[model samples]
Target: MREWLKQLREEKGLTQESVAAGSFINRAYYSQIENGVRNPSYEVAAKIAETFDINPARFFAGKISEPFTLALKNAPIVVAHCDLELKYTWFHHPHGVFTPEEVIGKTDEELGIYKGIPELIGMKKLIIEKGMPMKKFIVFQQHAGEKTYVVFGEPLMDESGEIVGAATVSMDVTEE
Candidate 1:
């Protein structure tokens, strides 16, 4: 991803200092990002993409296939996988109420949280039962608070092509 970003900047005849200054980010930070010494935050990526007149999603093309943990280290999102029973199996919490250990074997219902999102419930059901993938925007409401998220969910298939679970990559969109 760093290489791609650098290549794009070079192709655009843009310099690190100029791009960073224009994008309202520090030149040193941008330099580090280009040099592969540090990963850019999602916000920084968006700003840089905007400066280059590219959609941020398009700018990040091919980046999502990178290791989720490495790619999402500074992203305001959570990536999680759940069994067909809706029991949480694993999660990467960039920002979330639940921790890795907290929800490993429990459902949100069991934790008394984030259960008010009808859209998410339906999407998970579809993934588990019909092996469908979903890209959805949802507002999750728990008794404590509410947060908007853009969620992507896909069925996890077993060796025999049977759906065994669901994987979700959700970004917090409340600030946006």
Candidate 2:
């Protein structure tokens, strides 16, 4: 399925019917495109993009390279995506004792995993607000032990080039 398309639609607070109406396409056809059951023609893609006010190129930019995916999975790093509200939307390879379920849809402060570390939260906010990339070394002290991570974050932009969120990759640097 086009997960990114779904995310964009949800972010815009649009329904399939609304999008179809706006794009001059059938709702079922739009549903098929969204569910990956059917591929849209370039014309159709352009129409949908126009409806969303995004570039048609976004439709073709959905897939990540398998090699990059493999590299991230094999590396000792945690990757996450957070919306402008600072709530986690996607998390992978969590470190420490936290699980994905505990992190998703929650803020760092809400999870209490990075409590007393306002810098980490502030960094995410800065990236989103300033639309810039940032990197820092953060140390977390838990009951289990102390762990250090080199965290890198960049702003996520939407079709009109507005910052909508932040994406982060944090590699364990304690052993390094």
Candidate 3:
């Protein structure tokens, strides 16, 4: 669901009908968008953003950029987003170690892939708490043997500039 959108509406004390009217959209459509049943087009997203006085780009936060997509396809890189609690919210390019289903809603500690290794999780926590970007190199002993990765993490911010989560990109460097 677009939980953030719903939270924003609730924060503003706006009903679905009011938000729909303000965005020039049907209430049912707005409801569908908020419930994650339908996606808003750029124009509709812009209208809704205007109604909420937020950047229209907020609606596209989940979208991966073209370069990122290309890198995911051609490189041994993993990208993920985690909530403030360190639970995975979105993940891609698992590099044959895990799947989206295995990672989402779970923390690194829960996965056991980084068990006893605090640097990766610590970096994410630092990013969320301090709203800063950081990079680290970590090693993991997997069934395939020892693998190293260079991980970059940055804070994910809401429309009001509050840190809500952390986004990370990790590239395997074991062969380097």
Candidate 4:
């Protein structure tokens, strides 16, 4: 998986530093992950996915099925996926207020949607550092109203157990 991921990174013409910027992770951290000296959390996976323009599931292809919940696409829960570069791969927004066009090609720094949330970036860093899954409770304040969401992130590893990417799901918990 390291080779595959390294190949992907090379193919994309991105440097480890470029990928980790604003990703809440240091370049040395990612380098260790790639070298198999460290494990990566889901957040790291998401950042990498964004950097490489690949699906998070591709990193865990053999370990897990595609992580998408087809039924959740238009459901109340809005799921999203990103890579190490903080790019959004998939976003399921039932209300359509958040479209893929608004996310798919952009980085976290580029997207203002999560600009003010300190924990959003923190969570991503924690995942990369721990090489494990993590959860966070998030509430968004918008002109329409306020909504609460529970986010779950899991690291995607390659066949040899190297961290490659991450997949995330956001389930709306608004009572109203």
Candidate 5:
């Protein structure tokens, strides 16, 4: 429990004081909780979870090391991981919308769907700067038709422990 709190707090780049300020807990009290000297009530737990944008259940999920479980079948979605140079490293096309070859070496500017979405660039900037995940709903139209995608972007870190880029997964949620 202590390790989880420490790891998450560090990953978020927040000091105890900062987290306390955002959570309305005293710095010393938060320190005690993180150090295992104290256990927070349900109200405090909920507040902490909200302040961190974390699912409180995750802390007690127990023995489940995996942070997420997602299906990548023929689900009409496109997911991609990009390097700092804006080159794609990995991609998953659940709907067969576009071939991997088409997006592998291209930046967002070179991609048809994202070419003019300045908001996406802003989202990337926010994710990279804050080292957190962001989600938004986007509309796009292709040869087939128009669709709505629930896009999520999270910072990706490299070996030396520095954020290099991001991993994004967009799922089509429009009703057919």
Candidate 6:
């Protein structure tokens, strides 16, 4: 996969279909790039970058890690990760509800809102320190209304099995 704009798309809360609509490539091809199943050519990556209003080189600078499981194309999810210092490193795809910036470079305590703060804090701590993976359902109350999300968190481990960061995947389960 291209590893370029997946995280960015998640950040901007843009769906594959919407982002690829007017671009040269289609949603399937773009999904291939995002899923790490194929790599985009320089021209393709550049064209895609142009459509997203980001510099082409931005795609080349960093690689987006494929977390536990990628949400289906246009799937409602908000994924995030934090470093050892507990600063938000990756915050993307907020299911069209929560603010993306609320999680970026900020801790749960820092946000000081959202339901199940203690559970989230403990989950993150265990993942970052002990490399535990967890999955559970949680309810969050927002000004819009209350929604339940199936949330998963795990330690982002390195090649040596050392914990580096904490990763989270959240899918809205209110309908379920």
Which candidate achieves the best TM-score against the true structure?
A: 3
Runs off by more than 4 Å, candidate 3 = 1-70, 113-116
Instruction: Give the number of colliding residue pairs in candidate 2.
Output: 0
RMSD of each: 15.5, 5.5, 6.5, 11.6, 13.9, 10.9
lDDT of residue 5 for candidate 2: 73
Per-residue lDDT of candidate 4, residues 56-161 (tens digit):
5444532352345444545777666666665665555657465554666455566665422456656666676688999988776655677777878877666898
Q: Which pairs of residues have clashing backbones in candidate 1?
A: none
Among all candidates shown, the one with the greatest lDDT: 3
Q: Write the per-residue lDDT of candidate 6 for residues 89-110, one digit (tens) a residue.
A: 5667724543544455457787
Q: Which consecutive 10 residues in model 3 have the weakest lDDT in total?
A: 57-66
Using lDDT as the yardstick, the better of models 2 and 4 is 2
> Model 2 residue 81 lDDT?
80
What candidate 6 gets wrong by more than 4 Å, as runs, is 1-73, 97-102
Which stretches in model 4 have alpha-carbon errors above 4 Å?
A: 1-70, 113-116
Tens digit of per-residue lDDT, candidate 3, span 51-151: 97655655665584556666578788888888788877667773667876566656888888553258788899899988889999888677777789899
Question: What TM-score fits each model?
Answer: 0.56, 0.58, 0.60, 0.55, 0.53, 0.54
* CA lDDT of each prediction against the hidden true structure: 0.74, 0.78, 0.81, 0.65, 0.69, 0.69
Query: lDDT, candidate 1, residue 163?
Result: 85
Residue range 64-175, candidate 5, lDDT tens digits: 3223214555456676777666555456674565555455545666675453256666677787788899998877665677677788999988669798778888887889
Q: Candidate 6 clashing pairs? A: 10-92, 10-93
lDDT score for candidate 6 against the true structure: 0.69
